[model samples]
Target: MAKSPIVFAMANPNPEIRPEQCDGLAAVMATGRSDYPNQINNVLAFPGIFRGALDAHATDITEGMKLAAAIAIAESVSDADLKPEFVVPSVFDRTIVERVAPAVAAAAIKDGVIRKR
Candidate 1:
C-alpha cells in the first residue's frame, strides 16, 4: 500500500471521507458532492442514455447500451487532460449528452435492440 489508493466516498450530501480530509493520501478521490473535484453524480448519466435510446428507437435498455454510455462518459475526458482530480466531466459539461447519445444509440443498433417497426 505504498502508492496512493483510489477512494470513492460517494454518499449523498456528505461523503464518508471528504476530499480535503484524505488530501494527498488517495491517488483518486471521488464523492457525490458536486463541489468536489471528482463527483460521481447520476446527473452525468441517465439523460444521455435515454436520449440515445430514443434516438435509436430502441425497444429495450440493454446492458450493451449502458456500457456504451459509460464508455462515452469516460472517453469525454482526454488522456492528456486526465488526472486524479478530474476523472470525470462536470454534469453540466454539455458535451456529455452529445457524446453519450450517439454512442448509446450506436450500441443499441449493434445490440439489435432497436424498434422493429
Candidate 2:
C-alpha cells in the first residue's frame, strides 16, 4: 500500500478530484479553492517572503531564505493541532507573516546576502 498518499488536486476553480471523494483515504488533501481546507495558495508564503527580504535589507533572495520561509510555514501548524484538513495554517493566521519574516531574515543573515547587519 502507498500508506495513505498525499494528494494535491490544486486546480483553480475546480480540483482534479473533490476532497469528499477521498474521505478516509488520503492522508492530506489540498486544493487551490478557498472553500476547502489546506488550500495550497502561494499567498501562504510570498508576502512573508517579501516582507522578510525587505526587513532584512537582503540584496538578493537566496534559496536559503525560501527554504526558511517554507519551514516557518510548515511549523506554523503545531504538531498537536495537525490534521489532514489542517496541514497548512489558515492564510488569515496573523502569525504566518510573523513566523516567516523572522525565519527568512535569519536565513538571509546566515546566507550573508543582506545589505545591512
Candidate 3:
C-alpha cells in the first residue's frame, strides 16, 4: 500500500476571514512537503534546539531574534543545494541543532529576552 501524503496547513484564527467563516481562521496550506513546514509550524525546530540549549545550559529562548538563528541554519545549506521539498535540513543532520542553538541563544540575549546566562 502507498503511504498517504501529508499537507501542512498554516491556519490563523480570525473572525473576519473567509472560507470556514464559522471557524474564524485563515488557512495557508502546504500542498506537498514534509508533514509540516516552517511557516506552518515550529514542530521541526523547537525540540532539537531546546535540547542543544539545555546541553549548553541556556537560560531562555526569544522571538524575532530567533530569525537570525534559523537563517544561519538555512544558510548552512547552500541555495544550490536546496529544493522546495527540502528547505530545512533533516533533524538527524548532525550539525543542525548544534549550529542553530548558539544563534538562537545569542538572539535571545540580543532581544533582551534572556534575563540570565
Best by TM-score, which number? Answer: 1
Top-lDDT candidate index: 1
Reference-based lDDT, residue 83, model 1: 96
- Order candidates by lDDT, high to low: 1, 2, 3
In candidate 2, what are the lDDT values of residues 1-117, reduced to their tens digit? 266989999888989899998888889989999999998899989989999999989999999999999999999888899988889888889889999999999999999998955
Root-mean-square deviation of every model: 1.4, 1.7, 9.6
Of the candidates numbered 2 and 3, which has the greater lDDT value? 2
lDDT of 3 at 28: 30
* lDDT against the true structure, each candidate: 0.92, 0.91, 0.52
Global CA lDDT computed for model 3: 0.52
TM-score of each: 0.92, 0.90, 0.51
**Model 2, runs deviating above 4 Å:** 1-3
CA lDDT for candidate 1: 0.92
Give candidate 1 misplaced runs (Cα > 4 Å).
Answer: none
* Better model by lDDT: candidate 1 vs candidate 3: 1
* Candidate 3 positional error at 46, Å: 1.3
